[model samples]
Structures are given as C-alpha cells and as structure tokens.
Target: MLSLRVPLAVALLALGRARVVAQTTVKTVDLGYATYQTDASIVDGVTSFLGIRFAAPPTGDQRFRAPQPPATIYGIQNATVQPDECMQSAVGNATTPFRLSKRTAFVQNEDCLFINVHVPADLDLTSNASLPVIAWIHGGGYAGGSNGQNPAQTLVSNSNNTVISVQMQYRLGPFGFLAGETVAKDGVLNAGLLDQQFALQWVQDHISKFGGDPSQVTIYGESAGAGSVLQHIVAHGGNTQPPLFRAAMMDSPFLPFQYEYNDPMNEVIFANLSQMVGCPISNASLDCLRSVNASELNQMGQVIALDNLFGVFTFVPVVDGDLIVERPTVTLRKNQTNSDVTLIMTNSHEGDVFVDAAALVATNSTLAEYVANLFPRMNDSSIQQAVALYSNLTDVSAPTVPEQAAFVMGDSIFVCPAFYTLDAFPADSNWKGEFAIPPGTHGSELAYLFADAVPGLTFNNSAFISSFQSGFFSTAIALNPNTHGADDLKPDWPTFKQTGKTMLFNETTTGEPEVMTIPTSDALLERCAFWLSLSDVNAQ
Candidate 1:
C-alpha cells in the first residue's frame, strides 16, 4: 500500500484533511514533484520556495530528447530550500569586480532542470481561488544561467493582484543544443524551446494548486529570455499565452539563429573554442567528447569565441519550424499571431556593458589587440563603421576608451535587435514599442523593476515604480493590450506602423507616452533595413 504521507500541519489544511492551529510564518513548503520529492525552504521577505523541479532530468538516455513531464506523486514534497544553480560556464569569477553584487552567482550542477517560485507572504495555498502568475526566463546567450539567478518576491509583493514569479532552468550548450540531424526528426531542432514550452505546461496544470490564476499568466524575460518569449508566440501552431499566458513582455529580444546558422565564422568560433578547452573535434574524435563530463563542458565556456567576425552570436534558439513556427521577424512582419494578447517590445543602450573596459582588459589589453581578437577572416567593412559609430556615440569626457566601447556593443547588439523587432511589427500588430534610456544596458532595467538593486545602482525609485506599475498594467493589456494602466502617465500608447511610439521612463521630470516612427535618440534604420532584407542571403 503506497500510503502517501503529508506533514501534520499541511495535511490538516489539505482538501480531505482538516486541522486548526496558530498561524505561524512559513518560510518553506514541499512540492512533491515526480521522481524524487524534497523540501525547499521559503525566503524571509515573502512566500518563496526554492528547488521546485519543473521537469525530469534531461540526462542519461533522456539527453537531447524533448523533456519528459515530471512524474506525479501522492505524498507532499518538501520545498523548503533552493537547490544549487544550473550547470553553466562561469562568466566572471567570484574575484571579478563586476561579480560583486550580493546575489549568488555560483552553486550550479547538471541536474538543474528545476525552477524557483516566490509569491507574497500572505499567499493562501489553501484557498480555492487563483491569482495571476508570471514566469521569468533568464538570458545568457542560452549558454549560462539558472532559476536562482533572479528572485520574483518583489514583483509579486508589488503586484496589486495576486502574482507568482517563477524562474525555471533548461539544458545549455552541447547537451541542450548541439543541433545537427538526429534531433531535427523530433521537430524544428530547437530543443531548448521545447524545454520552455513543457515548463509552461507544468505551470498551467499545477499552478492553480499554488494559488496562481492559471488563466491570467504572463511570460516575461530579457535578452535571450525575450527571444524565448517571442519564440513561444510565432512557433508551433499553439499560443503559450492563450491557454498558458494572457500577457508577455519581451525585452531586448534577439534572434541569433536567424542571423547565422553553421557559418564558417562561427564554425571557427566553435572549433577554436573547443580547442582552447581541449575538445577540438580532430580526427572524428567526437565520441570521447560525447562521453566527456558535463562539468568539463561547462568549464569550456571560457573559450567561447569572442570574435564578432560576421556580426553574429552562436548557440541561440533557432526557428526550426517545429518548436518555433517561423522566424520572429517574419512572424511580426506578417502579423500571423494572436493579437489578443498585448505585447511590450523593449530595448536598451547598444554599448554600455559589453564595452566595459574590465572585460576588454580581462580579455586583452590594447585596442589593436581587441580588433585582432576578432576572427581573422573578417572582411565586413561594417566592422570599421561599427567601431567608429561606437566612438562617435561617446563624449570627449568619457572615462576611458572602454567606456566608449559600451556604446558600440549596444548599437551592434541590443539597439539593433530592439529596432529590428519593433520595425518588423506590421500595422496589424497589437505590439507597442518602447526603449529604456540614457545609461540603459542589458540588465539595467532590472534595477528599476527590483527594489533591492535600485538604490544601490543609483536608480530613481519614483520613475521606476511608476514604470514597473505600467509594466504590470501593460501585461494586463497583453490580454487586451490597448487597455491603459495609468492614463495619466501612459495615455493609451499607440502601436507602430513603420514608426515607433516612445514612452520615456524618467523620475525627475513628468513625461508622457508619445507616438513616433523613432525616438530622437535612435539612429535611422535605412542601411540595416536594406541589409536585413537579405536575411537569408548566405546560408553560412
């Protein structure tokens, strides 16, 4: 007899069992996931639970296959503590100055297919009601990141309606990606995307028990996360929002696979990087590589080619026509999506963080050296223009040469991606385009959205709080996007028509949402437009 056992206190509160006791603060709970269940402690500030398994391990025979659903359990699983972070390459080591934030950047492992959930402290798991939920996907070029990286306690606490913040982990690198032939038979080769879809399904089936309004969910992310969120909409025939999420926020979204797929430039990157980490695929010795330890594979993240040769990134989610229906750009241009859900398109400075001199100094010492660091076969004259444009964007009072490089990084990567995504929107879309200003870098808006990181980073609370609330309101709009959150601050922002509507987020001055083809700060899109028209020009 498999008699399931639940905690005495929790059992009393279960549907079948009943007990009454003092209402004490609970910092943790058990979420008995299939396979093996464990206790994950909650956080002090809010109702938080760590190490909630979202999917079964994608290891052993399960490698590269679409993730299997977590098994069901009759007993309660203790979710009182968070598991370690997911397996990933260490970007900046603990000693690195940029890695000094209080956040824990370590504690990773291969069996990291779990997610963390944080909600308001007063959340009543015993209630028969449901609250709106938000799922967060972290961005790391799809190479490094975990559910533990971002906490949703603040967002959930701030939300007027009940909200749940979830951060889930997916496989990375050769194990998660490594697209070729065998994998495509399953579908459009992007297995990582499938991992995400599965997690959303888990949310739909199980979130109600956790006090989440399954029908009012919102999928949100930044950078690669933004790309994942967008992929859900235009891919497969199903919508992640209709049944899964009613709203979505795509920030600094990028489509790396659309830009390049198995090109010589990136092959060199892979080959060279593999060599640096002692895994070069010489003499068809990939068999040994396949059996290599997962930890070793992650350590190789250090060798990833930094060469921006063809102005492309490697190992991103692809539009395999299976997982992702079509390229995000094409879908937006065609407006072949559910316009019922409101979409928020956001971007930031192209250069600030990437151009950080510390990274340059860490990687190389001189400008000429950095240029040479770029892949050797580089013939794109755009490289010269890219460098010049970066320098021109900065002021003579710039702190250092590297400080100016941030602008170049911003323009080439983030700014362009944001511009391309918004511009691709047809007059047929319910999409509204907005860009963060001034010192906006990749994760800067996080400072505003998260209160703890705000004052420390010199972020304006007043402007940010309103903006954050506006985001919540806009998420509501995703269900019916045209609905305004605060008419005083944002009076029904208009969707674009080859022209973007700008809504500046400033703390000191009163600003209003306005319409335009582009912000005054935006560089015209004439050239990038014509070039992008030839997106499929060369297959490499």
Candidate 2:
C-alpha cells in the first residue's frame, strides 16, 4: 500500500502549480480552420500571438492578384515568432534617416500576409471579455515596413488591460500596386489596399476570440498607413455598409500624386518594370511578370523606382475606378467617408526626410523644378502657379532653398492632405494635432509611442509619454481623447470644428512635456487651399 506521506506530498505539489502558470503556460485560440498558440511567458501583463496567417501567400499565378482567404491548417500553428516581411524595395540612401533604414535587416518573403494580435494576459477568453481594439497599419511609402515594426505590448499594458492591439502585413511595391491597362484587365489594381481590407474583415470575424469587441475597432496608421486610412475612409465611394471601422487616426498621411490606372506615366512605369524583368510590354506581359523569380522582380522594381525622381514613389495607389473610385480629395470634399470620427496629426516638418539636401543644393533647383519633378502630370502653367503661391511667403519657416523645398513638399504631400481630411468630416467628429517636438520631422513621434520597439532612440519624458498615450489610447478606447480616466496632465482638448484649434504636443525649453492648443494658422490654410485647387492638375 502507498504511504500517507507520499500521497500528501503529491497533493502539495499540485496545490502550488497555479502560481507558476502565468510564467510557463502557453495560450491557444481556436478559429475553426486553425488554432494558434501564443508565447509562453507573459511580458508586462500582455500576451502576444504573432504570425497568424490572414490570407494565402500571393505567389505564382496569384502574384499581383487580390489576396484570398488563407487555407485551413490541420494542427495548432505557432504564433510566437514574427512573420517575414513582404518583399520591400530598397528606398534608403546616405541621407535617409536611421529610423527609416533600420528595417533593412528584417527577413522578407513572398508568403508574408500574416497578422499579429496582443491582448492582456489576464483576459478571460471564456467570459464576455469584449475589450476595445486598435488595428495598426505601418508606413513605408507603400514600399517597405513590416507589421513587427510597431510592437503593441506596451500599448496594451498601458491601457490597464482594457484594449487589444492588432497589426497586419500587406504586399508592397510592385507586387501590391502594379497598375496599367494590362494589369486592370488581368489582375487587380491596388492589391495592397485589398489585402488591408481583407485583413480588417478577418479582424471582424476573429477578434472576438481574442477577447476584443469587433464593433469597437479603431484603425490607426502613419504615413502610407495613414494614407491607407484615408483610402478606406473613401473606399467604395464611402458606402462600406456595416462599416469595417468606427474611427480612424492618421499620423502624417502621405498623399502623393495618385495617377489614374491607365495614365501615360503609370503605363510607362509598368512597361519599364516588365522590360527590366525581361517580360517586355505585350499582351502576355502579366504572365511573364508572374513567371519571373521573386527576387529578380523585386530588384527590378527598386531599380525602376530609384531611376525616377529623387524623392518619389513609383508604385503607389492609383484611381482604380472601383476601390479607389476617384481622388481622395474629391471623395472627401463630397462628404462621402466611411469612418464616423477622425483624429489627424502632422509633424512640424514632414518633408525633411523625403528631400535630399545635397540634391537640392547640387541641382540649384527652383521651387517650380522641384514641384514639377514631384508632379510630372502638372502642366507648366500650374507649376508656375504653385511656385508663385509659395515663393514669396513671409511665414516661410526658413529662407534656405532646402527649407523652402521641405516646406513645399511637406505641404503638398503631407500637411495639406491632412487639412483636406479635417475639413471633410463634421467638426464635432474630427480632431487635429501637431507633433512639434523640436525639429519634429517625419516619424519622430513614433519613438514616443513605441519607445522600446524603435531602435537607437531614448525618450525619458515620462510626462509627455503619459500625455500622448492617454490622448491616443483614449480615442481608440472611447472615441474621444478627453474621455474620463485619461491622463489629467493633458489639457482640455477641443474638436477642430468647435474652436478651429490644433493641439500642439511639444516640450518646454527646459525639456519637459508641454501640451497646449492654438487656432489653426490662417497662412497655412491659404497655402493648402492653393494646393487643393490644383488637385485635378496634380492628380491628387
């Protein structure tokens, strides 16, 4: 017979096991077709489920086509490792910022349509734990960047376990946005945008399993990602029934020249890409491109993009007549948008990263020359009008040619599009802000939000981080930045229509976070109005 002492010892070991479960236990979620398991250890009270496939790999014949639903998997899939990034075009040079180029080391592959989800470790999956959700789309000029670039563990933990975060990957560069009459006839245009929409639909279907409320999703993004938010806002002529998202937050939306699908320049870009990859331009060009090796094709895309103007992206979203409908400016002006609320932010200097100082100085380019290069479709008269509008500005931030170029590029591509979005929504439903930390250039605010994720950056201003996160997470959680329980350090923010005021997030001269509100600048609005008037000419 077994001794009483041995039985008592076994019982004691079982009683102490619960204390160590959080550190060693792996979490799993079932979604009918597949079961994904999260990381074993919980960090900062957040558990991450990474690299879950949302769509099937776009390869072979599927290349350049819209993303299709992922095939069913028989066994539990490991979601602990970050997914490989979609093939990216090399867009960095000596003058490129370190923040943008740091991702050169990320592994890339064609099978990269995965999504990552982060939720509180203590969330009860069996119970009715319908927490808020924030879906992030990263910015890489539509050419580079991965879903892993912005980790949401800190964001989920900072929300006091009240919100879940999701990030997705989409095809980039030529594979996603290749356009022309040939592509329109054979493949989908703006395939990357379709990938994003497919991921959002996936979120609607699967987020509830992760303890998130599908109806309370907030879409947030930066640069091209933010521009994507604008695209979705105007998607389907703003008639997305049973809407995918209720709110949106755009950080430095990059609205470059969106050419029509069959425009001469786009056709030329397609022909050049095909020729570079040995496909040549013909009826079978699409099939030839599909047959080429992935690396060879991606390298050709980079070559073609770098061969073009210095600071322009070659394969951005175009007016596809279906998903895109028309220029975003036209759609927004008609008050046709899907999102119910908007929070838009711009950096103090958005153009610095895009413009090369040596190129501006070496060419001795005039404003008209720079503007012409940026928008090749604009006629000579319109170029001169743009030059005239910006040439003699008393409020020019700096007098140097580089500064002038930055101002012009920033306004046309980044800043002014923000104003268009702001003016599109009802004042009560919209809010705007400027991230003005000294020399507040493009992507600088990202460090403040994801300090640990961004490399080679150190932010010690706890107060500012607290204030900024409160406003952003508050908006995602409650649809208002000034919601109760948000950081008290932040001032009473006002809607854009209520006061026409822009909240400025800055640091005092002594290096402490300072939050204040100021009326929208009349001078800036004047310049934006001039740019908007030329939308038809610039293909905006």
Cα lDDT for residue 449, candidate 1: 64
Evaluate residue 333 in candidate 1 and report its C-alpha lDDT on the 0 to 100 scale.
61
Q: Tell me the lDDT of model 1 at 144.
A: 64
lDDT of 1 by residue, 1-540 (tens): 112444422322211122232223553343444422222222333555555677777665565577887666555455434455555532223213433222234555666677667666666667655767788887776766666455555667555434677877777654565444333433235667778878888788777767777777788887778777767766654443445665666767655535232444434544654565566455333444445666666555433523232223455665455555555666656654432454555544544544446666675544433333432333356445444544454322344456655444444345455555555444545455444544555666665565562333454446445544555544543454444444334445556442456545433334433222334244435424533553443211
For model 2, the superposed segments whose C-alpha errors exceed 4 Å read 1-24, 40-43, 92-104, 455-459, 484-487
Against the correct fold, how does model 1 do in TM-score? 0.74
Worst ten-residue run, lDDT, model 1?
A: 8-17
